[model samples]
Target: MEQEGEVPHVLIFPFPAQGHVNSMLKLAELLSLSGLRITFLNIHRIHQKLTLHSDILSRFSRFPNFQFRTITDGLTPQNRTLGMFSDLIRRLNSITKPLLTQMLLSGELGPNPTCIILDGLFNFIVDVDAQPKIPVFSFRTISACSFWAYSFVPMLIEDGQLPIKGEEDMDRMIDGVTGMENVLRCRDLPSFCRLKDPSDPALQHGVTQTIQSLKAHSLIFNTFEDLEGPILSCLRRRCPNIYAIGPLHSLLKSRLSGEESSLGSESFNNLWEVDRSCLAETVSQMVNDVMENKRNELMGSVNETAKLAKTSVEEGGSSFRDLERMISDIRFLYRRQREAIH
Candidate 1:
């Protein structure tokens, strides 16, 4: 337990993938800026790749409470690809689970985390140390629609929705997913769900992980209430404690800009170098098409949505307020844990 006045410390463990690490790292930076202590855990290879490719180290160097730690994933870089994801998960459960347990119980990492912001992809295991009762908040890097659809995989299979007969059935409605019945189609389900076999390992693994997400104390999404209101409503029926305080990257900019906090240029933690060569021509052609051919058809809806997005992340917006609530809730947990100990 932390001393009476010590700041709340949060440990962030993102799945060692580019998209997962990128979003969670932004959240980590956001929390550290808000005066919370943060310990970001990464696999050895991802950490090295991040350090070598991005200014991730110097970016968070100003925050004394921010730290980075790593453990082995038991795989070489050549072995870590989309095809080997199942092997990676198995290895993490077998090899990395012990190290994580030790870090929690032995205090080898620093202060015991007031809470853990975990990657939803690794929801297969939630047994962090049981003694102290650490709260875990599952963060899914994907959109709520995508996660909601994944959660219904088992239901879809039981209802004979899987083994989608043929390309002829591609446009068939996917009624199994609650709020998205009208919008979701067989072709729209994730690529893995398109397989001829319903019992495919990857598909089953996805279903298991998504179903296990409900085991977390709460769920966090990288979206805003205004954007996914119906889907969010469906999710709340299952897990009520959810924080939709995103588009995180934009919200972070809004918060920092409002506070007049001058954090340097935006930094990206991509595992591979970004190729910008085609962007110039792409942007010029896009602008030309939008101005000439798409003007009447697209301008109104585009402008309206852009305006909503702007308002959603500004002061008192749904996302901004939810972010404040999330921070407050973490501190509340810290105080409650301390009181229980006393």
Candidate 2:
């Protein structure tokens, strides 16, 4: 437990997938640095992978205000079994939601949790959000374009753009979704949307997550406006309170200290083994290019991404202020709750 007057506490739960965990972990660190107390919840199986493949536990200890908690993912060691994994995900939400609710109501996580930042992918968390006095905000770690594509599943159905007839319809343009008339095709839509059977569970799950996001107090995306401005505009209809502060790697790199943070980021997304061979290949290419007096294509492209990321985090930037605003809102919630209790 923290001291009575500690910074407002937050509980963060990420989907156990490697990519999801990595982005949310960075967001947790950012919130912690901004003077919030953050408790990051990890599933037992994923945490074990971090222990074996990365430095997650040791890396987080340096933050005075951040800590971790774990619960079972309801799966065995092999997360590869899709049928088993899908069943486990359903059980996880039903099982973990109540457990998390119990933890919060007991004040075991801290004095009072002002907010719960959850991965937007889970349907069950919204039910947890209904518990009195605690709010859940969703953080969607997907690109805004993909989210916008997913958001239109219903519209597609209405326009007969979905339930694609066959492979022949795959290449047809989806004219139903406004703002994407020329840009989006059936094949370009999210993979789940490609399923000919509209009743497929996987397809439904993806749709549910996108729709469920609307119920969250706020919806945050790990993308910046310059990159996905049009799709983000479309998303605002469903989620008015949206924040796009991403290329999260850039945001973290800009604000954090040095190598320690970088190293932690390495395993943050690599639940699988990394191909360090890319490094060897790149260095070799650079040497060859220099001898031939030719432009280095890979290095040039990387530098471009780095440049864009850096530009997005400058003073008075979208990501910087949105992060500050999120922390402030949580503190405001904390104060209001305290006064109400008295």
Candidate 3:
């Protein structure tokens, strides 16, 4: 039960992958900075790797209310590369779900977590029990463009657009995607769209996740409106409550403008080692091209992008306002629960 004047707590569970953890960790830090008590849940395997690579504990230690909790992914010491999500999901249903319930009921994890921010892929876990219930929001650590592309698979299949006939059909233009008709093509769709077999697990994963998102209170994406406005507009028709505040790392980084705010911000934990040499080579070529192309003519747009990230999460700022709304909703839920209990 929440105490008087106590900050409402939020439980964050990422998909246990490098990119997912990196982006969500940044969001966790952002929320902690905003005065919410945060409980970051991690799979032991991924958490182990993250600890080995970076000072995750010491870094998050700055926030007294921030803490890490780990559950087993039920995978071996081996890395999860392919067909691993299936096992992870099975373990979640059998192991983690019950464990989460136990934790919530026992109050062992602190005052009942007011809300759960679950990964979009972990669709099976529903509302947790309390006097009322813990509201769960699904956070997809992917671009709105890719998410919207995956969500269209079922419609494309019904209309005979997916499962391309052959190489000849690869470059064919795709239609009926409400906002992406001009930009999307057969080859441009997610790799899952290329699977001709309906029973294929990878393809099925996309379908299930997209369909299950409707069950959540809100759909959150680490993408900003300027980049995915059209897709977000279409998404809102389905989920209705969608938060697309992203380039999240940059957004959070911009907010920590003080000199001391630089601590641990540089650690972007990557499970897959980044090939900086290839990156450097590509960046060098891009620099030469940009220097010659006079992209300074397009500098206004670049500055606008930077300005958006630097904007505080105030009434008008995209991320600032979305996060404020989230906190407000959770606090309201907490108050209702307290009333019911009393």
Best-matching candidate per TM-score: 1
What tens digits encode model 1's per-residue C-alpha lDDT throughout 176-225? 67777689998887888877787787787888778778767889999988
Give all TM-scores, in the order shown: 0.91, 0.86, 0.85
Q: Give the runs in model 2 whose Cα sits over 4 Å from its true position.
A: 1-4, 78-80, 83-85, 126-130, 257-269, 273-279, 282-306
Write one digit per residue (lDDT tens) for candidate 3, span 244-295.
Answer: 7676776666557553755735666665555666777788888878777667
Query: How are the candidates ranked when ordered by lDDT, highest leading?
Result: 1, 3, 2
**How well is each residue in 137-161 modelled by candidate 2, as lDDT tens digits?**
9899878887777888987877777
Candidate 3: stretches off by over 4 Å:
1-5, 78-80, 126-132, 259-265, 272-315
Clashing pairs for model 2 are none
Error of 2 at 251 (Å): 0.7
For every candidate, C-alpha RMSD to the true structure in Å: 2.6, 4.1, 3.6
lDDT values of the candidates?
0.84, 0.76, 0.76
* TM-score for predicted model 2 compared with the true structure: 0.86
lDDT of 1 at 238: 92
- Show pairs that collide, candidate 1: none
